[model samples]
Target chain A: MDHNWDFASVLANKTLLLIGLKNTLVLGSVCLALGLFFGLFVGAARFSGKSWLYYPATAFVELFRNTPVLVQIMWFFFAFPIIAPFKIDAFTAATLGLTLNTVAFSSEIYRAGLQSIHKGQWEAGKALGMSYWQQMRRVVLPQAVRRMLPAFMNRAVELFKMTSLASVIAYGELMYQAKVVSTISFNPIEMYTSVALIFFLVLFPATILVRRFEARDTFRR
Target chain B: MTEVLRIEGLHKSFAELEVLKGIDLSVNKGETVVLLGASGSGKSTLLRCVNFMEIPTSGRIHLEGKAIGSARNGRVAYAERELTQLRSRVGMVFQHFNLFPHMTALENVMEGPRTVLKCDSSECRRRGEKYLDKVGLGWKADAYPSQLSGGQQQRIAIARALAMEPEIMLFDEATSALDPELVGEVLETMKELAEEGMTMLIVTHELGFAYTVADKVLFLSEGSILEQGTPAEVLTYPRQDATKNFLRGHNMFRLPEPQID
Candidate 1:
């Protein structure tokens, strides 16, 4: 057994690691913001159904939630260009896949949040002369957001971890860069450890944020 | 004086569970009518129907001499926009004191004037403060609803309704949520409103308050008005056995004993 561990090689490619870090952050942020937007839309559409809006949104959510994320990534990267011909790059394909996945999960979280608000809320809004949209915008969303923060933050961390799947599409994010460094330096353990550390650097703070937000509204939960 | 609100042959049901059964009711300009009823007696539903919150199955409602309910393709309909306007005209206070939890007492009062009435910010602010003062919450304008007690929140709700300058106000068991000790403060505010001749319909169990403040008291049972008369007549000398039984069942009335010579 040859025990020759080289930590220097892993640290030496700081530049490549930094590029990978930047890509991870960019993808994570975009996925978080857009994921929430589409997730809220899907959740609201599911809840406020006129049948026309409900079935299609319900199908979209079920399709994304039921399938594996890896399959979704592969489809968006390889098969989507053939079918839709959008000609999306690896980064765009990964972002799209991650967005759809996050939204489906987040939509369920949001539906739970929206349903928890008491019926008295709607009656009170009506009594105040609030239009249906005004009640949702002014009253329901504000209350639901407070209830949804912890779940949203948890899903955000999950989304961050899921970014590793983007590596399958050659997205050049942290995991892909780690694999390239390992292949070149022939030091799989150290290279992968460095990548895991990078993930910890990003994910630990998100977990803390969720804890803090939950602490602030302990009564609500 | 004109009739501010009129309900004729109003019927409402929920999947054959009839809530309001062919009820006829009216209120003249500036009249304060209090409805007394047991739980599940349709008093709340009737109030909701008057504001068009629950569309009547079949009925005619007139507000300020204009029909509030209309027929569309042989089916009665209330347009969403019309319902919004009708609700604005008739503000309501709920049993649980459903104040917007995020807003301060002042902001709760300001929402209607700013959003529905389109009052300018300056006017809205001024009127909101004034109404808060009217409801005895001027000192608590900046306090959030959750920070306030149930009674205080109920008072803010009343002030919020008053901010709309509604031609009529509806109260659906407004004081029921308050701690028994705190109920007096909210009842005091309503009494003040009644004394000022604000056109109002109240659904309440506070027998003493109805006897004191109501121009007329309506007693409801099952899905219809069991009886209606001046407070002294209905609460004291009831003609209907159903109304008498209801009052006795709630332990809300006691007949005077015969004198022995």
Candidate 2:
């Protein structure tokens, strides 16, 4: 069977695809900002020696990390509103699931980065009369953040891809919009191919940049 | 002479293992005391105890006559906030130098003053420059730790500690990590500090340096002090078998003839 590959239909709906792209960016940025901001504190809690902090943080991380992102999104959107105190829209549910997932994964990255620093660095700070926070802010984080950079960028890439799962909840993100356009135009192949190309175009440069960061000896000796 | 630091009945334990068993020692103002011992002899632990880096199982540490921790029943209880303030007054240099790899030499030195002392950037820079000059690393102030040699890094470490203007400096085998040739530069910097009348408690295996610079020397063995005296008495004529055995292995450098005053 010979099939003609026509690109006109896909290009004609550029406005709709553009709207989908905007929604995707908005969702991805919001979740990333909230996840990383809160992830540091949760990461510190996971790194804490005290059982009070460590146990709860461990449980939170394990629960989110062990489950699938799709299931989490479905649970938030379909099942959560019954006991929920406030109205849960598709965007809110998707944000809740994706942000927590990012938090769980990124927190581990933060924890590992902090752990990689030598104990002597902490002692050096303490010996200089720096408080615990001072040691972390001035000494530990400055060094740890550099090592954590590549890992965080990798997380951002994974997070952007995971945003597609919001389509299951009909969140009107890029993937959801693509599905609607494909069903309406009866061009599943072109619509889906266009979505793949769009993702590759956005993410390929980011991955190359992350590899460069990883390859360079940024944290010398 | 005024006493700058005093440790009395200092005991430290890691679970079932006792590393420092009821040790007692003191350093007066501007005095240089050298601690000699084998690896597990508790010299490092004793130095760490002074800064509360290794919390004492039971003991008392006095810095200029102020007790470091509150005695609770039989054990000493320390508040971390108190320890932070106490540590600022007692600088320490490690074997690995422990310089912040990300910061320049000047920034590393200025960190203590800027963050802990809450000094303005200009004031911190002045103190940073002064100490770097003292350690003979003023020219390398803009260099990162990774860019410097081990000896240069160690000198910068000394500058970083000195920037705090600590009342007494502790050197825990400060030159042990350097190359054999680089060791001399760090030791030279340390000797200059000792000569400048800076109170110092140094744990090192450099017997030659101890013989010349130390006002008092203490030999530690199996978590206890085995001998204590001038370099002449302890290095030349150690009475204990443990001290004698430790010295024999370290006879690579000849001891200078005891200067009879």
Candidate 3:
């Protein structure tokens, strides 16, 4: 019978789409930056070779990583304000939940990069009279960054995609906007299709870039 | 000669395995002390302990009359604030060369001086070049470790250490990992360093390198000093059975000697 597709109505709601797109991009980018920094710090803490730091960091990673992100979103949005000493908003809840979630997974990537370093490199730096921090800053991290790049970028893409889950907290990211647009337009297929298309448009080149990074790093080796 | 490095009762054990059985030794200023041993004899461990790379289970190490890196009562005194300062005085070259892979030969040499000494960039670069040239690697200053030959990489490592102008140099079988033909070049660089009156403690199996360059030779067997004397005395005319056995098959690794009946 009639296989009719109308993207016109959904796409015509330019303001709604723009707001959603902007929020999604903003949330994704901000959380990504925060996640990367958090991941590196947590990763460093885990491998700091000190039992005090390592155990807690490992526990923290396990707590977040082993749980579903949606549960974390529930925790931040619903449970946090009840248990916490302060009030919060949906956006803050989404950001906090997403940041912690991203940090948990990416820290493993960071740990892998850090572990790839030879013990001799640390000793060489030490013998040259550099402190542990100095060795890390001067010798270890530079090499680790190169090795960690593709994984880190992959994680970043994942982070951006994961921001779609922020809609669960009523934070009004892309997926939320798409849901709203579909509800208003009575066109689930069209609105959702647009949403999927937007994600593909943003993340496909990113995947290719990650692969290129993997290739370049291999060639560098 | 004044003592550059003096160690007393240096002992180290990995779990239940005692890798160093109370090594007592003194290296005089400008003395080239070669540690000769078969694999697992703890020669590398002894060399490592001197620089606090491996904390001695018990010992005192004195560098230039300063008892540092560990306390007198075998307790590790964390010179946490001054560890970098302590490390600056002891330079070590590894069997694998361990040149910072991401950096150029020149940058690897430059790192210690620039970071620890706070040497200015141009000055560090100039000194890096000078030391690279000293080790006959002036032309390869820009090459990465993977790009350079093993011998060339080891030479750059030597240059990296020398750039710091360390009071004593430690070579933990620096030539052991090199290609056979490549071994000579690194040995020659080390020999030149010895002649220039740089105090050296070398762990090596190259008997000829030991005979030619060592003022003192120590033979380690099963984590203890089995023999110690002049190279002619320890290498050529070894007194201990362990030293004799080690010398009989110096380069014959991983094989029983053919029974010449």
Candidate 4:
């Protein structure tokens, strides 16, 4: 097998790759912020004893968690536009799918974190004359958030990787740009390798940070 | 003497099991009432009812002559806001000394004033320091609950309750979870509080503490008060055989007088 590695073509398309990288960051961060913000409420609903809140939250979580992420994105892109009240662009479709997916996964983390706190903490708050929201915000969340950090960092890493799946819908993210460059350059090996290297360079630091948090948590325990 | 707390026909039931059949009690201002009974007795339940921590199945509780919950059908209905207000006035110290582990001792003491009373931070801090000093824990204010001993943590919990300036304090076996050697310090703090004329309702197995500090004593059997009188009358000479048996089991038929410095 005679093969020669050529990096010139891939290096020449740095501008396009940079654009792809920018789009990936934008999508990843937006989804992360929205997902985490909404995830807290959903998690609280699921943790609530009220059937009215618990049932709907449970249904939403199960619907997203049980299905595949690729399928969710595709449904939003290909199937949703027919019934959607507004125009569903590639970015819109991808954002909706990934954000909801992250919400569903991260909500369970929040629920477990909230549940890990002893019931006595709530009783203590109540015994001090704190209202329900006051107890949750002051006493419960401060403690629970510390335990939930590593899990949330892991979710962020997973979410960044999930952004690559938007290529299936031609969203022009990193993976999608790699496909276009490879097809035109006729160098699948070089283009795909660069994409893989890009992802690794970005995510490795976050993975290390998560590991550090988990270590500290274990030691504290 | 003015009544600080009063309970009329307080009944509590958990599903099919009834904890308190019917209870009628009153605590005057600056009075210390001690409750003594076996494990299955309804002493803890009665304390919880005063703060609306355990909603009565059917009964009424009055704090300073004001009824707590509204009557709905045969049971009492509580509003969350009202319960929160009631708890602020009636502080409780639990067996486990449930201090917020994340907060420092001073912060734990300050939390009630800051959040519930909406006091300024400086004012809260001032009150926090005062109560911590009252409990003889002024030097340990910066320490967390985990760093403190069981007795020290219980003292901080007492400070936390006291910072709210409650009208009455309820102790549900407050010293039960402390180590035997550590129990002295906590009991000593409680004795100081009693000497200061704070209204208190205590549930404990320490007959010595009751003998020395209690203004009145009540012995509970099953779910009703079997005997009620002065400590000398109830602890030393009980008319009820059940109270006598419980006292004998504790080996406290004749409690030695507690030494106070």
TM-score of each model, paired residue for residue: 0.94, 0.96, 0.94, 0.96
What is the Cα-based lDDT of residue B1 in candidate 1? 84
The per-residue C-alpha lDDT of model 2 at residue B213 equals 96
Error of 1 at A135 (Å): 0.9
Off by over 4 Å in 2: A219-221, B72-75, B252-261
Give the per-prediction TM-score of chain B.
0.94, 0.96, 0.92, 0.96
Model 2's TM-score against the true structure: 0.96
lDDT of 1 at B136: 85
Using DockQ as the measure, the top candidate is: 2
Q: DockQ, in order, for the candidates?
A: 0.54, 0.75, 0.68, 0.56
Quality of candidate 1's docking, in CAPRI categories? Answer: medium
Candidate 4 per-residue lDDT over residues B151-209, each given as its tens digit: 99999999999999999999999999989999999999999999999999999989989
Q: Any residue pairs clashing in model 3, and if so which?
A: none
Judge candidate 2 against the unseen true structure and give its global Cα lDDT, from 0 to 1: 0.93
Between which residue pairs do clashes occur in model 2? Answer: none
Q: Which stretches of candidate 3 lie over 4 Å from their true place?
A: B69-76, B251-261
What is the C-alpha lDDT profile of model 1 across B7-54, one tens digit per residue? 989899999799988899889988999998888999999998898778
Tens digits of lDDT, candidate 2, A56-135? 99999999999999999999999999999889999999999999999999999999999999999998999999999999
How much is B7 displaced in model 2, in angstroms?
1.2
